[model samples]
Target: MERAEQLFVETVSASLENKSVSWKEPLTLNEWQRIFYLAESHHVLPMVYETVFRCDAVKKTMQKESRNLLQFYKRMTMNLVMLQTIKTQEYLELVQFLQKKGIWMLTVKGIICRELYPKPDYRISGDEDILVDKTQFEKCHKALLEFGMKPVKKGINIGTEYEVSYMKSGSPLYIEVHKSLFSPESEVYGDFNRFFMRSAENPARILVEGTEIFTLDYTEHLFYLICHAYKHFLHSGFGMRQVCDIIMYSNMYGEKINWQLLLGWSREIHGEFFAAALFKIGKKYLIFDEKKACFPEEWRKIKVDESLLLRDILDAGVYGYEGRERRHSSNLTLNEVSRQWNGERKNPVLQTIFPSLKSMKNEFAFLKKIPFLLPAAWLIRILRYEKEMRKNAHKNVTDALKIGNQRIELMRKYKIIE
Candidate 1:
């Protein structure tokens, strides 16, 4: 790894472990900039900033570096903490409102994982993810609208999509109400939904700021974290924040988790090696202690190149939003996975130009009601893409294809594809 990236990993790992960074050399301005950008992109800026300030070396380096950058970090971190506080209160209120309306919601990912952190507000989340019973989806939808939250996509409801997003006007509080844990339309991860079919029926309640909220059971929640990371990995990539979530969750509930059962579920999804690699990465760089971790002996047998996976995760950033080309390249890799699973080879370019009706239904919800409008929708989508990427369309596509091929090779190395 490059020096900046190495320092970033060390700093973040130290922060998560509640330890001081052990860097001896003073970081140059450029090095600090790169490290800060990496922390920002990976959505761990607050944690990194907090940990770095506690280090004597970083403090000396900061005295020599530009103070403006330091101030920027301070401002951003404070804003994030404030936003997180507001969102948490809003989430508690919404949960209470939903409970009164006879809606059973299981909070997942964002809020649940946030509490596991040292400073809950340090872990910034874009939105709240809640899983509700399919039968109670309409009631949940109504409750959200009644709570002054508007649907992000108009006309989104049960049977139309796996999840519906809502945003409150004049506020940063966004909530994603999921009818199923994973989208059934997803060719690769659709099966993941089956694992959580009974999750809402028997959930574990936890208190957040004196308000009780429901969440998945310990084992299932940890498995969901792995599956969530795997989903992002197949798409583009997932960053260190996700890895930290796994580490923290494991640390808190290591003794309570059913490691064998988790392994079985992971193997069912062909994610055993990937899951093992994540834990391995955690132990190696993030101060995750395997001796105390409740992983099975089988995980040690799983051979995966941790460095390659770590590099990919760092490059991809949070949910692969770091680069446009990388996001576009994900189409090729995803298609390759589908082909391997379903024994069908789809030309990624053709698939992009002419998406299936089900795929088009997502962006053009009207297609669900009027199937005949697909051609018009396709044309509109193509026009939109053209307008957005008119200047570098060809170059971007070429680079995406090149990167896609490289990622496919990486997938093979990781045993995700053959």
Candidate 2:
């Protein structure tokens, strides 16, 4: 990492520990802006601002820039409070409704994750991830609708354990009701069945706004988080917030977690190398101690450049959509939507043309019970989404192919895919 980038990471990590930062050589306005942009892009602005705003040296150095910076910080704080409040209320209502319907549900990331942070609003999340049993998933979906959570679109990976229903409109809150931990096609963490089964057997209970809820135990959740980060790291990019989550999680549960067991799990998914890489970075910049971790020797010899990895983290803004032109779009292009539907299937075009069962259900809930109407429902979705799909027909296929190849190469570099 560059000296400035290293210090940026240092400052953000220090904020988590409530430690102040001082530089021997003062930073110029340009350097300060660079750090601010990196932090904002990485989705750690609030935490970074909270700490840096208190540093007199930083304030004095960035005097000309302080007004805008303070405005950004204050705006983020208010938005965070409102966003989190809506998410919490929606989450509790949805969970309670699901529970009343006798469908078991577990709150995953998002607001549920905020509890692990040093400050409640330190982590900002736009959605709520609620996991439910596959058998009861439809009922859970019905319950969600009954509770007024609207689906932005059909849930992808319908029958799979990792299907997601996005509540995008009609309400301020977004909820992703997941039936699986990871999709079957997920490269490293394809063993969603095992993770789901294990979680079912050893679920951990917690309180959210005084309501009892369950989630995967700390060790399982830690492994899941690593896998989640690894997935995003490969597909687009993930920022510091994800890294911070792992660090805070480890800080809170390190002693109780069985590192060896987690190591074994990482090996099962061929994720040990990436897991070790994250731990090394986390220890150096976030949390964990190098001497205490039993990271593999091969991890140290990984070929990827540290600077490139840092760039991926920063550019991958929240949820890894940074640098992608799609992030700026109000809605997904046909090709973009197709890319999501492609999953791990070899025939990307075919997958894009044919919607998943869950997706069909999102458009026509009756298909779940009637089954035979799925083909017709698929046709309807195709026609309904046709105009949107046609808008991107002129996009360069060659450029898309080039980006895909680059992603594969980067994934190989990080050992996320071979």
Candidate 3:
């Protein structure tokens, strides 16, 4: 690991473990900047800033060297905390509203995971995820619209899309109402939805600030998180925040979680190796304690390249939005999954140039209503690509191809794909 990244891991580990950070060496301003940027990219700036501020050594160094940067970081973290506070209240209200409308909503991810942190507000989620039954999806959608949230996109329906997103014009509260946990249209992971079939029937209730909210049970919730992370890993990649979620969730509810059942489910999806690797990475670098972590006995024999996995996670940022070139590169691995599902291996470049009609329809929703517009949509897409490739496109494409091929090998190494 690079010095900055190593320091980042150390700082985050200390913060999450509720221990004080001890900086051994004074870092240059550039080094501090890099560390901060990494925290920002990984969406853990609040946690990082909290630990750094609490550390006298790092605090004194930043104060002596650059007071303005320190203040800026403080202000940024405070604003995020404030926004999160408001969002949390709004989310609870939305859940209550849905219940009044006779729609049963089960909250997921951010809302549930945040409570496990030392400071719940530090783990900021970009949006809220709530799962509703497909039968009640339309009613839930109507209720959200009635609650003054506007749909972020058009033509999204339960038949084709797994979730529909909404956002209020003047609020930080964005919502995603999911009819299914995973997209049924997904070629590689369409079967993942089967795991959550009975989720709503026996939902778990969690108390958030004196209000009771529903979520998946311990076993199913943890499995859902793992599956969610694996889904992203197969495409782009997920960042440390995701890893941290696994660590925190497992640590808090390790005893309650059904490790044997979880392991079996993971194996059914061919994600056991990936899941084991996550736990290994957490225990090795992120202060995750396997002794108390109630994992299956067989997991002890599983081996994974933690360094490679960590490197990929850091480079990918949160949900693999680190760089345009990197996102483009990840498409190659996604294409490999497409090939496996369809049982055809086409040239990557050719496939990119001429995507299937279904793929084109996803990009240009109009093509779904008027299939005849596909030709025009293809031409428009090519023109847009040409326009985007005006500067250093050749080098970018070369880099993407190289990185994508390397990541495919990484996927094989982790047994994500056969």
Q: In terms of lDDT, which candidate is strongest?
A: 1
Global lDDT of each candidate: 0.84, 0.64, 0.83
- Where does the lowest 10-residue lDDT sum fall in candidate 2? 326-335
lDDT of 2 by residue, 289-331 (tens): 5434444444455543455566667656766675433232211
Clashing pairs in 3: none
- Residues 39-132, candidate 1: write the lDDT tens digits: 9999999888887765666656655454567778889988888988998888888888888988878999998999988888888999999988
Regions of model 1 farther than 4 Å from truth? 62-65, 155-159, 345-349, 381-389
lDDT, model 2, position 241: 83
Worst 10 residues of 3 by lDDT: 57-66
What's the best-to-worst order under lDDT? 1, 3, 2
Clash count, one per candidate? 0, 1, 0
What are the runs in model 2 whose C-alpha is more than 4 Å off? 23-27, 61-66, 154-171, 185-190, 289-308, 325-410, 413-418
Q: After superposition, how far is residue 41 of candidate 2 from its true place, in Å?
A: 2.5
Q: What's the lDDT for residue 317 in model 3?
A: 92
- Model 2, residue 201: distance off in Å is 1.9
